[model samples]
Target: MSRGARFTERLDLLWLGATVGVGLLGLRLIHMQVVRNQHYSELAERQRTQVIAQAAPRGRVYDRNGDIVATNQPAFSLIFLPGKAQDPARLAGLADSLARELHRDRGELFERLLEAAREETAIHLAENLPLKTMFKLSELKTLYPGVDLIVEARRHYPYGAFAGHLLGYMGKIDRRQWQRLKGKGYRVDSWVGRSGVESRYEDVLRGVDGEIRMEVDAQGRLRRRLDEVPWQVGGNVLLTIDSRIQRAVEEGLRASPSGTGAAVALDPRTGEVLALASTPDFDPNLLLLPEWDSEKQAVASLPEFNRAVQGTYAPGSTFKIIMDAALLQESVVRLDERVFCPGFFQVGNRAFKCWEKKGHKWVDFLASLAHSCDTYYYSMGLRMKGPTIERYEKLFGLGRKTGLDLPGERSGNVFGPEARKARKRGWYDGDTANLSIGQGELLATPIQMALVAATVANKGTLWKPRFVKRLERPGRPPEDILSEPVGRVDLRPEVWDKVQEAMVGVVKGGTGQRVNIPGLVVGGKTGTSQNNLGDDHAWFIAWAARPGEVPSLALAVLIQHGGHGSSAAGPVARKAIEAAFDLASAKGHEAPAEGAM
Candidate 1:
């Protein structure tokens, strides 16, 4: 072979090797781009595109008379799009400038931005921002890359602190709630009701959120909305509460010297709560703001607790009514039976003293209730026994949840045989004596007491107390709703008559005389429950007019640390009843049946 031939052959082999290498490289590229394209595309989409959720507006709450109590208002928020920002310094500068424009602390705003950035692909600068600031930020989006504006709905209460406890307040969605609601599409930015009616009706109040499909530009800005689905606003909640009566209860409670207490007024015929008031309430608007430390501290410091359904206190003389019911139920004591009282009764070695040291020589059931004679009830308690008393207590809805639509209701304490054993105590004669007068181990919430009053007013039927009357959606028909009834007891009409007479005497000539309203037939019981650990709790339970009047109103009032039911609690009831009647008259309704003490 010649030298020229050898060189040509070597060049041909080199060309063939280069062509084979190029063919292998092209095959590898095809495998990566086409065969694994979906996996890579998903990875890229995760980095560049994010799914954000929008919250739905909470439902509106209204009084029975169609007055708005709670609603939602439009709010603005500042958001960050990480895909558009190039540097942290620029992000910090934009946040600081925005904070200054909003009259907020720049440092705080910067800290929040950094914190949000750490967890979210795009951080929210501020939630519920003012509309003007949102518009300003939107216009200056060019100066602040990755920063955007979001509009939201915030809960608003127009009545201020009037029915704060009953209406409750919403708070930020916590970690546990976020996890629970994540599957349901709830975001961290969502707010939920934490107490009262708001918490109880959360499902109905939280409306369905909608969606928007939008096309964006390369700069991560929304060019236009392609398809939009409007969000469904929550239903309207109509409560049985009367705002006028509620305001009157608040005013009367505020006028009292006692700083804390609760009052609940109900309609005996339907078991509908007319007015529920808890003193030292906080403004619901405070919860709508972002920084709630100061407002939370203020609420914590005040006696803002909902005492009407939460506070448990001894019943004092009011237990006598329960005793009366038990005696009638058991046939242990007749309505006309007379018991002798000498101001004190001896139970074994212990001498139980009555309210009147020198009691009336002979007292019937009516007179006993009027004078709140401890001796008379003590004698009856000895005959009735613990089991019988407990039976009547349960029947009257004592020591149980009222099942009202509002949240945070407590089951008050009633000591049955099993309960007594659990508490490491044994039933005794003295315990029975104390129990007869509604003291010792017995405790009840204001709503519980109000139910008891209603039970007696209705002669024997017990209606489950209810707050919400109807639920209606915008542009939809209203749906009437009701709570499940517990059961009913049938007491003789004669027994109700006797009990009614005694209760009426309580206001006319007995300890509750101070609460007497002229021309108003007010049947009531006064209770001064002694508290060994603190000041006595004053209590008054009453039903306006007679049973024949269909019990237009039934009420229970409790004044924490208030001395006497006659002086402290009774006046509050009187004022509440008067206001309720006045409210009815103002609405062009006939004057409620009037009666004297």
Candidate 2:
């Protein structure tokens, strides 16, 4: 074949290939533009658009009686979106207009806008807006496109400071917490529960955020609105608290001109906390506010401490309940045993004097308990081993945390060999004498002491203390927070019988007489713990029931620097008991008839 003919054929083939490539490109473009137009448009919009997220409202908190304690109220906030103040030349004029309309300082708003613009963040100019300002913003929304008025959820506690410690408070997540929640929809402005039930149930209370995507021009100005996503609000949380009982107990704790103290009341049978009151409590709303640094510090100081679980102190004579049980349980002491108190117990030349300076000569077991004779307990301690009392302390839920649901619980020192090793001290007989009388290295929290009373009232069963009973999740059955007995006292039923008898005697005629309520059978013990820093800490633990029957409620009351147990803390317990009776009557919790329990 000729060279010219071959070249012509090659040229024709190349032309055909180029034409086919062009046609395929045209078809691909047509398919992308026409068949998948929405897909390509979304891709283009995504390249230009930015998403702004809005926080979802947190869950509400309710009490056991179905009364709302914490909830969200519709609120508005003035936010500075940088895209609205794009032009540097027009920024000051825009800020001046905002200042006049929103009553903010022009210079301050300008600074905020400048910062948000530089950082490219949506900054809150003003929050918790007044109704007048909110209405004005709504009317002038079109005039100030950059100044967005968004409806937000403001946390509201309707009962003021009621159950503040138990309910906890909300605050922005710190740097450390942010690391754990980076992908969990947490942002710089995101708030989390810092303490109490709110902290414990953060996963259940915090809701997912929603966002809206908006297309912006090259100058960072909004061009058009795009895709949007809505938020799913959190579920409601129900606490195991009785509002009436909580108020009454808090009032009782504050009734006295006292400085620091705690009082806890609960159903001994179920370990359901009815009332947990600490005198030094704070209004969570006030603590979470900005520009309230000093106020927050004041509330965060010692006075606001949750003494019910966090305050550890010598339980004083209230600890005698444990001592009595240990001795009776271990068969270390006999009911027929007699001890004579000449105001002091002598151990190797050291004399531990009783609160009563005079002598109660030759008192028996029941009489000794009614009188709170230190000498009798000292004698009992002398018979036991050095670590016996300490071992029993663990059994009685002292020297250990009660496994309470609240945060910052303390496992107070139950002076034993282990504690002695920790403190670098050798065990001694004098320590046992002090331990016998509920003194020296032995320390306990108000909740722990309350558990002691509960154990006795429940006939030696130590139920795990809890604040929440059930979680009321949205569109689901009630989830019961079940808890079993943490421990059980080793004493026999008859031992508890004798111990109950002694406790009854103390309330009826002994140091706890002041806590006795008329027409109710009450069992209690008084404690006056010595304090080197100030006056003695007064304490009282009690339980109330129908005459000659098992108790339904148990309480522990402690007053720091209070003079004497009955004089300072007894009246408080009495008031709470009276309120409990009143609440029972109002709720129609009458005694069961026929064969019912």
Candidate 3:
């Protein structure tokens, strides 16, 4: 009970209490470092750093000869940063100023800023800012704090709308698109390929985005760069399309009566798409602008339809080639057999009229094909009784998608026995006759028709049509895509021989004379198909050089509202064939242009 002993015990108790408190603090520190370290670290980063995505340049699209089809250029955008804005109320005023400067709806831009503010993210007010606008914005920086200006890469189509449909366009990513692409590093504001080749080859064309980490103070003012990650350049896409021949085809279609249609020319042996043209096309450059949607919607014919691969039109008399091929394949008709036509043929109390009001008195099988005699086709069709024409159609790459390497390709519709059953109707002689003449339930795209011409010219070998020839990445070996063969038609060479002879006669002495090019020995068929539409769609399919000559090229043309194939589409096909010959002779054929592809 001594006073000194009591004082020593009290001192020891105080020391022990202090030691326990110190130990507990150390344990809490360890727990934070071990269990909640990442969480705290991320919180710290979110508070002090801003992650800015640096867009990687997209790959360029090139023609066969390395001509530029699509590329990228530096562009500026006026941005609104809600976090950096001095006053949230000032966003409306800033939006109005930007709208006035950029010629946009002031109220809509204001609403967009408010929506972005609620989401706590930056919003782009205007894109593709001109130098003058950038300079003006720079001068007014004092008036608008947090009105950020950023650099971006916007798509540039050097050829404008030359291959617009195939080239496609880029647009702001929506929630649905972002959901699909977010896992692949696509941000909410990312621009994605919405259509065409841009959409089909998005993975190949989209470059890896770089990231910049910026340090900021409590007030959200940028201090300095904390880290940076450089981006990987996108790979290049070299298409089989030839711009020279493509231009010629476009010009030729422009000169046509309808001034709106599609043309596709391919190498019969390789299925390389030499030229694909859809007239009435709008410039892709316009698609990048704010007014693009309205401008495009104003056009009566949607240019984005890409009629070459997407349009489903009645093949018209051009389908006679397939009908005859069926006759030869089924052994139902002989080349020497004769059928009489007196302008019209009667089937089940109904009559199908020929192009000629007073038809030729009598014509053999070859003559039938040469003159596109409707009555002869009507008679031949009535004999088949089943899906003979449909079977022939499948053999010649019709009644289905030609498998062209473009988006939005349609598998053309044709009524076979199965199709008739599906439609709850029985196949009739009249139906057979109508289908035989390419009138009734037959629908085909220009690419399909072109493939048919190519199949015939390839001596029954059907090759899958291809647009892209190779893939090229800078500082890397190019990836070449050789020609792909879909399948070969197993008909006798003599069948094609007879068909070729008749097609040549079509150009030499019949309806397809307009497509006859000197020294080329062209073989072609003209088609004027009827529809409920005001005028029939004119169609022509031709091969340059003669059959048995390993034809260099084959083409198909369609003119919407055009009256006759021979006059409306024939000349365009002829001109496109000529252009192909010229492009072949050019040195660019052997090698790409300098700084190209």
Q: In model 3, which range of ten residues has the least summed lDDT?
A: 588-597
lDDT of 3 by residue, 72-93 (tens): 9989877654453345567767
Q: What digit string (tens of lDDT, one per residue) describes model 2 on residues 38-130?
A: 997865554456677777888888898899998878778776555533666566776877677666678987887788777666566666676
Which residue pairs in model 2 clash with each other?
A: none
Task: Give the poorly placed runs of model 1, Cα more than 4 Å off.
Answer: 1-54, 83-85, 95-123, 130-143, 148-151, 211-227, 292-297, 300-304, 334-337, 358-361, 416-418, 421-424, 473-477, 546-548, 583-597
**Against the hidden reference, what TM-scores do the models get?**
0.84, 0.83, 0.85
Name the candidate that leads on lDDT: 3
Per-structure clash totals for the candidates: 3, 0, 0
**What's the lDDT of the predicted structure labeled candidate 2?**
0.79
The lowest-lDDT stretch of 10 consecutive residues in candidate 1 is 588-597
Q: List CA RMSD, all candidates.
A: 5.0, 7.1, 6.8
After TM-score superposition, the amount by which residue 344's alpha carbon in candidate 3 deviates from its true location, in angstroms, is 1.8
Q: Where is model 2 more than 4 Å wrong at Cα?
A: 1-52, 89-112, 115-123, 130-145, 212-228, 290-304, 421-424, 583-597
User: For model 2, what is the alpha-carbon lDDT of residue 462?
Assistant: 92
lDDT of 1 by residue, 104-193 (tens): 778877776666445435555667765665677776578865567767777889988878888888888899999998787677667888
Candidate with the larger lDDT of 1 and 2: 2
Better of 1 and 3 by TM-score: 3
